[model samples]
Target: MFKRLILVLLFLALVFGGIGYWKYRQFQQMTAQLTAPRPPATIASVEAKRESWQPTLRSVGSLVAANGIAVTNEVAGIVQEITFESGQRVEEGAVLLRFEDSVERATLESLRADRQLAQAQYKRAAELIPKQAVSKSEFDIAKATFDAAQARVAEQEAVIRKKTVRAPFSGLLGIRQVDTGEFLQVGTPIVELQALNPLYVDYALPERNFRELAVGQEVQLRMDAYPGEAFSGRVSAIDARVDEGTRSISVRATVPNPDGRLRPGMFAEVQTLLPQRDDVVSVPRTAISYNTYGDFAYVIAKGENDALTVQRRQVTTGRVREGWVEIMKGLDAGETVVRAGLVKLRDGQPVTIDNSVELKDAEVGKQ
Candidate 1:
């Protein structure tokens, strides 16, 4: 029994010795891994520099006509002729439509004959009154009759002029609605006239931005119909009162439309160029990293052997224009920053920059 107990003790000792040796082997492997040097990461970066950048505020709006008028008949008559074609350009005072003036012309002629007869009677009566051949009352009655006939002629002339419908202003005529010999009533719409040489763009500005806008400020305009094209103009008018419900002010800009390509009611994107900020800093938009915490970017700092160290920075960004953002704070001039590959990075991670092709300011401007 004593010999059996000694053999069992030896077996337990062997098991414990095997476990300790295995643990020692694991420790040695971990130690070697910790001592090994990590490889440098590949990344693209750009150097911060100062450039003249004009900031712009962007909004959406629509194109409108500066002056649009609906041509209507002033007198009720039969439509005699439509002198102008649809979509035709007409000058001020050009005839648009003509109503039948047979009745009006006859009335004018009849009043003229009566005026002539009254004038003869008045002349004859004046001669006799001065010579004491006729009484003063008879001469006075003749003079009054002459004046009434003259007034009747003037009234009929006005009615005849109203028969001819003329363009009130120089503009392009819309579709013609009346035909020859068709009877029209007073105030009936004949056609629409729109002046397109100079266009007006209307948009609403938020109450907070009201202070930034002013008369004669330069603005940029873009239409979805013509992509990649930009039109320039200036603010011509601003609403004096703000809307009580929306708290927004209506703004109008005058754009030169010499070619008459811009039409009324076209959707447009507007950008107001506010005054340049003297103390604002800006950065490429790609440098910014957005997360749950906020927006962040990695700035390159010098490390050992001229290598770069990435230090994460929190930035307060303002307006973004042409793929660049105006930085309110958290960055400075002459600093270097990582441009790409920022997703696979940390606060203090080491990075190796491959700047064979640097980020050009012109390329960034195009975006």
Candidate 2:
């Protein structure tokens, strides 16, 4: 019986061993499949070339109207008529609002009638005094009364004019603040008026760039509201004082907005062209990969059998213009760089260049 038990045990061990060996063999085959060399990755690439690069300084800015204000009432009165509609274009001296002026007009008329009577009395007194038909004291008193009456009439007319509100300048009007028959107090807000033809952009730059900044420097502006559209302008003004807290200088540029598409208080991305740099190596912006450690780009290297391989190369980048970036270091003028398909790229990976489409240097400046 013991001999039979030993035989059964040996048979069980042999079966289990075979199953384990089969499993081990399967794992080795799987590992070999995973470790095998992958096929060459197809990618688009561009040759790094030395070209004249226009250095640019980028900053954030805001759009403002060339002339903007909140229209307000100078004198208090009940609004009898709203002469202008909301969002209407208005010219300087255009009547915008009219107040109740009936009482003031009546007062003016009464004062004018009194003044007419006083003038006649003064004329008669002057003639009589010259002929000794009236006393000098009586002539003097009549003249003073005539002058006072004229002054009162002028005052009444001035009061009547104050009841009407006119546009101070030509601009687009905002929403009306007060309705007809609504009484408004002095200095009450009426509407917003803004000159929208030439908009102003206010931006700040680092103090180190003060030397490069100046009036009349060319500026390109991009607003989120208008995608893929670039508005051009020149630097209009530079603030005299530098911000102490941020150590940046404030700048203002004037941009033409003939169609009134740009609005005040809109955020903008500002790019101020500094000066052109000659003989600088540049490549397509897509060739660069940024990470926390640093920036890098994949360079295509030629190998045996005319095979292509990508070598990971670290690069120091500088000013970016249009869709291209300046390579300040770690690259040469004639090296080919992978422009697309960087996500799947690895160091020393084999690559197949499908250079059917390549970026030209001329396209950089067009941006």
Candidate 3:
């Protein structure tokens, strides 16, 4: 019985040993495959090039009419007529509203009649004085009466004119605030008037850029109301003082609105074009990798065995124009950068350039 048990144990041990050896051989093969060097990753590359770059200062702004105001009545009166319709464009001195001026008109007429009588008396007195029929003191008294009557007439005429409200300038009118027969007091708002053409845009810029900003600098604007469209203008005025709280300077630009598509109070994105620079180097925006640490890109460098290797480079980026970005520093002209396949890249990793797709600065700008 003991000999039979020994034979069973030997068989079991041999069977287990064979299974372990097979597992060890499989592990060796897998490790060898995992340790082998991988082929170079295929990537698209673009050469950094020098281009004419126009540096821009971006800001948020609001559109304002060059001339805008709330039309108001200067005197209190019952509104007899509203000559302007809501949203109507009117010219300067155009009668917008008329009050009940009948009483004032009658008063003016009566004063004029008295002045006419006084004028005739003054003339007869002058003639009589020359003929020695009237005393000099009587002539002086007649002249004073005539002057007083004329002054009263002039005052009545002014009161009559005040009853009529005229537009101060050519502009578009808002909805009427007062209707016909509605009474309005002095300084009561009638309507809002805005000059749409040549609209003004008010924006602010950091005080650091104050030296670069000046009147007549070109500006590009975009508004959410008008998507996919761009408006342009030139700087018209700069504030004399910087804002103490924000350390920014106020700037105003005038944009032509011949079509009148732009309206006041619209929010706008403003880009103030600075002077053109010829020394700026630019690259395709796709080549840059943005992270919380900073911006970086992978530059292609020569490697051994005629192979191309990627070296991670830190870059300082500036304004982005279209699909390209201005490389402010850490990159030189003529250096090749990986435009795509950035995720698989590592420092000093080998790469194969597939020039099948070439990215040019002009082409990126068109995007």
Candidate 4:
């Protein structure tokens, strides 16, 4: 009975061990399949080329109206009539506001009548002096009196003219500050008038660049209001003297804003174009990848049997132009850079070049 029990135990152990070995073999096969090599990934690429790109100096600026002023009254009076509504466009010499001028008008009429009487008296005095009917001193007094009356009339006319406010120049008006029947004191603001077309952009640059700046240098502006659109103009004026306090020079650029879309006081990014274009290795902006490590780009590496692979290369980038970025370092002209279709790309991984999309990018470069 003891021998039969030991035999039964040995048989059971052998059966269980065979089942464990089969399971181990199955796991090994699954692991081998999971570790199989993958096919090469297809990607679109572009060739970095040395191209002529315009160089520019960058700065922040604000838009200014070519002509801007707070329309004010010179003489005090009640606002009788506002010929223009709020935010109205007016031409030069256009009547904007008028004050009650009844008292001034009446005074002017009286002065005119008195001036006529003085002229007649002066004429009579001159004739009598020639005939010896009046002394020289008497004629002189008569001439002085006539001149005083004429001066009074001229002064009254000027006072009447001040009652009516006219536009000093053609411009668009801001909100009305005074209502009808409101009394406005001297120098009280009526409205803000700004010439919208041909705006001026005011910016400052370091005094070191003074030697490089010129009156006709081209300037471009980018505003927050309008994205992807650039307003360009020529440098109209440069400040006569550099500011001693800030050690900077103020620059003014005149931009043609025919549609009047650009308003005064809008903040903008300014770029002044240099006279010469620079030869740089330029690639599409998409080719660059920015990460915590650093900026990098994928470059195509050709291998044996015409096989293609990608090498992740660290690059130093510079300013961006129309649609390309300047490669300052770690890149060379005429090298292929992966512009798109990066999927699970590793260092030295096999890749297939698909020029279908790359051809479109080349066409855009021509544009």
Candidate 5:
């Protein structure tokens, strides 16, 4: 029994020894991997240089019609004729609709006949009063009768005019709202009218930029419908007060849209260029490494024998335009910065510059 126990102990010792030897070999392999030399990373790079950049403010604007309205009838009447078609362009005071007014027309003629008779009587009374043939009270009565008849005629004419609807101003009309023979009540809509040659753009900017805003400043506009086409406008008005809730000031600009391509209620991207231009150090937007702590970029430094190494730099970025960014601080003009392969880079990491891809990317950005 003692001999069997010794054999079991020997087997246990061999098992543990083999396990320890395997673990030691694994440790040595990991140590070698940790101390291995890293290879140089190939990255695209570009040189930062002085660029003339204009500071611009960007916002989304809503297009509005300079003059827009829903045309409505002022009086109740039965529609007899529609003179204007849907979507027609009409001039001011042009006839748009005609309401049934046979009764009003007949009334007007009857009043006119009564006015003529009263006028004859008034004239005869005037002649008699001059000769003392008629008393003053009788002559006054005749004058009053003539005046009442004339007023009745004028009143009937006004009623007839109200039955006919005309365009209040020259503009394009929307779809026809009322059909011929349809009864319309007072304040019933007839159609929508809008002047389309010129449009107003309404947008707001932060109150901090209020001092930079002024009337007559040029504005640039872009819309998805017209890709690559930019619309120009001028700042027409600015609100007197800033909104308390948003801390923004309202602004209005007038854009000429002669072709009527820009319709009201369309959204557009608006950019306002400041009066001053800045000479700033500019770099490609791709070169920026945005992080939660801070924004940074990798700048290449030349070492002995012209070996390139990347130095991580924190940057204060300003306005960006056309795939480029303005570097406000932490970098200088004429410095080379790594433009690509940023994910595999660190501070003081060896890198090799490859401009073949970088040059092609720059040309594409320009286009």
Candidate 6:
């Protein structure tokens, strides 16, 4: 019975060992399948084409009113009436506000009557002096009296006109600070006026960039309020003095605001057009990868057996504007560049082209 038990145990052990060996073989086969190499990463690409791209320098700026003035009251009096509404369009010499002018009007009328009397007296004094009917001293005293009265009348009339405020220029008025019956002191601010038909944009650029900028150069403007809308203008002025503190120079441009949508203090971006090249080699910005050593782009070279090999070409860059960049050296216009999946690229790695997705410009301005 013991011998029979030993044989049975040995048979059971052999069966279990066989099962373990079969499982181990299956695991090894599965491991080998999992470890098999994957196909090399395929990338989408675009053929490079030669195109005309103007060189441009882009900078940030802000919109300002062409003419800005603070309106103030010249006389000390209670506000009687405000002729202009806040933000109302006014013409030059239009009545803007009126002070309490009852006393001034009365004084002006009294002065006018006195002035007429003085005119009659002066005429009689001249006739008497010519005829020698009156003494010279008497005629002189009469003339002096008439002149004094005329001066008084002129002063009173000037004072009366000061009570009413008139618009200095044609523009839109800002908020009103004084209401009717409110007494305002002299030089107190009443409102603000701004002319907005032709808006001014002011930007500061570094002194190094001043050499390329000049008056009458064409510029494109982009505002934070209006996305995708590029306003065009020409540079109107450039500051003669560079700011000593910041080493920058101020630039001003005039943009046509026919729609009157642009307002003062709106932040803007300004792009000045530099010199353009007649024929230049350029490529899409995505084709080039920048490293600490240099900027390099991938160019496909025809290999044996219809295989395309990527060659890394070192390039020098110039003014990059819009979506394209100018390649100053080491590249031809018609070469093909790998657009996507460049991260895993090497000097001589074999690549398969499966260009299904086209790469486009992805630059969006951030505030």
TM-score to native of every candidate shown: 0.80, 0.70, 0.79, 0.69, 0.84, 0.79
Q: Which stretches of candidate 5 lie over 4 Å from their true place?
A: 1-37, 117-148, 356-367
Q: Which consecutive 10 residues in model 5 have the weakest lDDT in total?
A: 358-367
Candidate 3: regions farther than 4 A off: 1-42, 124-140, 290-294, 353-367
The sequence of per-residue lDDT tens digits that candidate 2 reaches over residues 115-168 is 999999999999899799999999999999999999999888888888999998
With candidate 1 superimposed using the best TM-score fit, by how many Å does residue 218's alpha carbon deviate from the native? 2.3
Which residue ranges in model 1 land beyond 4 Å of their true spot? 1-41, 131-140, 276-280, 303-307, 355-367
Q: Model 6 segments beyond 4 Å from truth?
A: 1-41, 133-141, 304-306, 357-367
Lowest summed lDDT window (length 10), candidate 4:
358-367
Every candidate's lDDT: 0.85, 0.90, 0.90, 0.89, 0.88, 0.82
What's the CA RMSD for each of the models? 5.3, 6.9, 5.5, 7.3, 4.5, 6.6
Clashing pairs in 4: none
Candidate 4 whole-model C-alpha lDDT, 0 to 1: 0.89
lDDT string, candidate 3, 1-367, tens digits: 9999999999999999999999999999999898877678888999999989888999999999989999887789999988989999999999999999988888888999999999999999999997989999999999999999999999888888889899999989999888889988899999999999999999999999999998999999999998989999999999999999999999999999998999999999999999999988999898888657688888999877778998888899988988899999989999999997666568888898886755444332111
RMSD (CA, Å), candidate 5 to true, equals 4.5
In model 2, the Cα lDDT at residue 63 comes to: 95
As a whole number from 0 to 100, the lDDT of residue 333 in candidate 4 is 96
lDDT (tens digit, per residue) of candidate 1 on 328-365: 77888767888866655777677888866454444331
Once fitted onto the true fold, the runs of candidate 2 whose alpha carbons sit more than 4 angstroms away are 1-46, 121-147, 284-316, 335-367
Consecutive 10-residue window with the lowest summed lDDT within model 3: 358-367
